[model samples]
Target: MTQASESHNGLPTEIPSCALLQLLANSLVLSQTAPYLSCYDVLNLAATARPFRFLVYHTPNVFRRLELGNVKTAQFDIDAIDRGGETWRNVQLDENLTEDDFYSGPLRGIFSNLRRMDILRDVQVLSLDGLSVTAELVHDILVDPAYSVRILSIRGVKNLNERKLRGALQYACRSSRPRGTPRLKGLYVFGPRDTVPALAAAHEGSGSSSPTSPATVATAWNNRSQKALSDALAEEPEAWYVRRGSQFPHRISSEWASTLVACSGIVSFDSVLCTGPRHFNSPAWGTVNTEALDAAASSTAPSVPHFSVATHSLGGCASCGAAPEGWTVWGEEVVASRRESDGRRTSESCMTDLARFPLLAPPPMHSASLRVAMCPAGQTVRSRLPFIPTVKQQKARFIPRCFDCIRDRYCGGCHRWWCESCYIGPRASSPGGYAASSTGPDSVSSPFPNTSAASDDNAGLVSKIRDGVCADGKCSLGQR
Candidate 1:
């Protein structure tokens, strides 16, 4: 066996030649074995020996998918909260290091080390789900010239707003050299809704026609918040900002759609959801701003191909367009009833003429309280100073029903319309009892138990007259 094949510790001391090892590694490709090796698996193989390490490090084609954080099948050692921040700085900078070696390190370190190792340069699919990503990190990875990243998924990352997202995309598209090269093809960003306005502001600032100033952007955001608040107040006086539930994790705002339209080279955008305070009749997702997208597509150079934007929620309820079955807007009332012997006002005695309705109530002479009425238009109309309204303008106020539950009680606290089932309590016996009843022409059953009463009033307007029973079996709207 000679010195070359000499045995040491009951093992041959001679190692396989680099060429032979390379050939063996090459043979481990998809045609012979599995199509791909995980980032972890590749790193493990690399740790075996110097020859194997060299083969794994140089052979970038072997790794097509790189999942960083905890996925369905795999759980990374990196902390979800710390996001490998503390661990990354201490990681040893050795030549044999792979991304899996930095599993305990930050995403930034992994990306940087990948660039240093030249491993992920050919990586096709990169999933950063269940990870904490910064704007700068996102920009660096997406715009890195060394990376030919085709599919990028950043779902479940907190605080990643539309502006940062759009910036990364724009940077990626711009960084693609000589044009016509495949930039990022697929992007999945299911981030929080609060990040949307910043993206919208950025897009507005970069507008070709009229650029919005920072002050304008601030004003616009404030206005949007104020509008939301006003709408909430109209539903109920004690309303505040409350998150609405949806099938998807992230809330898709109008600004999000605009951001998607503005960005280029994104083939498929997934996991978009509609922002709530969503009506029962609201579509799972809002319509994509196709007009803006079309306009964007038209403005872009013909060389840039338009990719399809996808969302989980898109269509809305058909009943959403129609007004509630019975709604009226009437003025305030001034009740004057004498106590009865039975301690209950008789039906005949309680009945009052419609003309006697307080079109203009007598203002309290001494009281300092200012009564502010929320108009149907979601604006506050003060009644301190009395003003005569024309007969034509004296219309009955219509209260819209909860689109989902068809219940009349709208929660001002959450700014969401809820039926007795949602706002009050859970149903006792049957789930079907809580569901919204279909009002099809041929359907025999009516949502309201007193259908005859509803029909008697002017065009179903009397439906509002019926008392609303809450989940607790108490009449929330009071007895008729």
Candidate 2:
């Protein structure tokens, strides 16, 4: 009777914080398999009664990523303290959002919070194809010393201009970043190869140094902080690496390796054409930048990409173009682009062949110089070289025709080939079907088919493949 009276009175507080926490724990366990009880659904339970609400309010740490939708309204903008995250955050506004709603309202509020914490941040990965982020706002982020944004993806952002984009990038590393610890490491600016440079130029938060002495502009791009990336996992499986081309392993060749080697950490290396593959939204370059030659090669590939007269080598109309350390400007650039339109015949071209890329490719005109973007999170200053070395004229003169290009004319070992080289593997046989060395794993199969040097001891087996005979089943020399 006394217990019933106490229950009816419902004194000051009915339950303790421990009881609330216990409820949360129970809900989490129930949510494991029940499709109806989502993690968010568990949070909603807090609104059910006072005990449940106490648990949700006290333990906020359980939420790492906070997202809301049409029905919900919320956000998170705190200092990056200890946790590797960006402080100047940006999220979509609470109302009706269109394509142009990127830089204002909700995003601005988020960035303001980031500024409070002084950490440069980035969206995990996003394309800039139709975004309306203006160059001015991006410039503001670049110029700030505390700026720490890396890898800005403006895939299809067309509103950006070249000069402004350049300014934004130069602003990133223009001076030292906040150093006691790293908030933001490197920046990556990606998009459909050609369309992105302009945006990168304008929205380039991967700042540059001061424009004082002429020589200051002469800096080489190389990636830093490799130890951190290496220790990330003993050896990053091929899955961890991504090239500009295909899905899985990010297919890339030697031509794109220099840029890859320059980026410090384990990065998803994007492939862009130095002198070709200009179309960004075409069906051909749908998911990646895969060229024909890369698709054919199998087994272990060349450590680096080989160039060709028709492919890699590029000579610029360099009043606006970039080659290595020593290259001269040949002419000015003119960039005119024609997007996919209403039944209009499309036109595009390569970076070198005047016929393909006449007038700085596509030809309307953007800021052009004889330098490539310096750091993945950086940009290059404009400078002229005392001399210009052409790619086609390089010593190797490597060409890529096919995976099985073992023809004598294209074989580097054939002595007659200069333009291109045939494919060979360390595995078993070379083009002439000879082992690179008899001691390696790929050495000719034992019993020595046609191996005259040892014929005196093993005459019968040695004659099997030596005289273009396949006496024994599965002999490569005989197949050759």
Candidate 3:
């Protein structure tokens, strides 16, 4: 649309709207608006005008985040490519490939599509999650001066070798670039088999009172890696990797542990793996002996051995007295030997929820001496107890669970379990010390010295909790 106005010579002068749009496009207004626009929205807007198209292609903010690995987008591309007689699987070609070779590969169309959309240049956050991208492609992207990419996510990139990925990251970190140019400050590499043993060990040793935080775990693991970033954590603390799987898999290799530790800068990594009740249904819960599980559940003495050497130094469970932090309630004792004549007791128990816990060394079918029932919660009103009773309380007696079973909403002082709702409710009961508030306002004073406001302060509360106390302010357990 054009607007006409009278000129000094009485001739009509035409005014162009594109000139106004162009000015605004190059201004701070466009920068502000670009972040809120999706990749599609920006492309659509650019298509509407030549000036917009040029500005959108050149502007860094317009494509700061390029999510090439989005599930829906990937699916759409796959369908579209299939219709065009193209394959979707990655190319398994000879090593030391080039960009020209990539153009003829399975990922050829994707790169072409990226070029068509002008995506890669100046992209700060690029997510190539679940793509079978080669290490060369990833390294090229990281090293490219055109890209301002600060974070690169390569989760589920199966073909990416650890050594090649390491070299690429090391090169990018040490590469001499212009001032104010961003280096790879954040990297996420989550493959199916990747696991960290240091974190698992730390988690096993950590307890209700002295929990191993993610930051602490990262720092400890980073120390082991021996490669420190100049200002990695200070700039981007959230730089990390996440496995969409179990906290502790049954079989973990030493190589995988070393790889996790060896990951260097911009790779400033942390792991937040999945945990909780639903994890029981996973394939990790395969072996179980019904009769042994039943027997162990009803056994008078349910003693479990400590597996980790580190956990031994941390002492045992407060309730069970001898069971260590990561103690196993399934599988035979470490001392037992197995024979083929002793067939696995393939019972209905293996298919049940009770078989959720990770198996110890011995095959569950071979021994009935080690299996124990899973902890189940009970109703609060009927129980009328400070500590929440297990479901077994309705039929039989209460059984003390391993630290892993009763993780959250549990008292570290006495290892007593509490319902999730009650722990976070308005009472705001502290996990430390004997929770007098849960019993009622008329409850007796805490076992520690003073019950005054000053004594209930942060320092006093910590001391009282550390010293140890349970429901009735009478737990006789000593400090760790």
Candidate with the greatest lDDT versus the true structure:
1
Candidate 3 lands at a TM-score of: 0.36
Better of 1 and 3 by TM-score: 1
Residue 297 shift from truth in candidate 1, angstroms: 32
If both were scored by lDDT, which would come out higher, candidate 2 or candidate 3? 3
lDDT of each: 0.39, 0.30, 0.39
Model 1 stretches with alpha carbons more than 4 Å out: 1-38, 50-60, 70-105, 159-161, 170-178, 191-247, 264-267, 271-480
* Candidate 2 residue lDDT tens string, 1-480: 222122233321334335644444453533322222333564567578665554444333232112211112222233222333333335323344432333433444445653563322322111222444456645654454444433233433444554555444544434364443222232333323232111112213457654455444332111223333445445322210111112122222333323323322322222222322212311122222223223222334442223211222222211122211122122223334576768665555323212211111111111111122221111113212232446633211111122222221121211121111111122223333333345653334322232244322221212222122232334332110
Question: Which residue runs of candidate 2 sit more than 4 Å off their true CA positions?
Answer: 1-103, 110-132, 135-170, 180-182, 186-480
Candidate 2 yields a Cα-based lDDT of 0.30
Error of 2 at 408 (Å): 17
Q: Is candidate 1 or candidate 2 better by TM-score?
A: 1
Deviating ranges (above 4 Å) for candidate 3: 1-29, 32-38, 71-109, 112-119, 170-182, 191-266, 270-480
Candidate 1 per-residue C-alpha lDDT over 1-480 given as tens digits, one digit per residue, 9 for 90 to 100? 445443453222333455445354553452123124456666777798765665555543555567665432233444433333344346545555543344423665566767777776766667676665656656656556677766566766644555766765655555454564435555656432212122233234445544368886777677667766665555421111112222244444444544444443333354221122222112311222222212222122132122212222111221232222222223333345666998987433222222111111111111112121112233224433333566654433323221222323322222223322112212211223322235642222222332242332112211221233332333333211
RMSD of 2: 25.0
Q: Per-prediction TM-score, please?
A: 0.37, 0.27, 0.36
- lDDT tens digits by residue: candidate 3, 1-480: 655554574322321345656454554666667655556677788798555665667555666666555434443222221233333355443444454344324444555576665675556666566665677776766666656666566665545566766666555555374554335555555323222133223334446443368887685566545423433333321111111112232332223322323332223422211121212322223222212222212123233222110100112333233221232222212233334557754322122122222212111111112121112123221222334336644322122233333333234554443322112111223333233345554442332232233332212122222222343465444332
User: Candidate 1 at 398: error in angstroms?
Assistant: 34
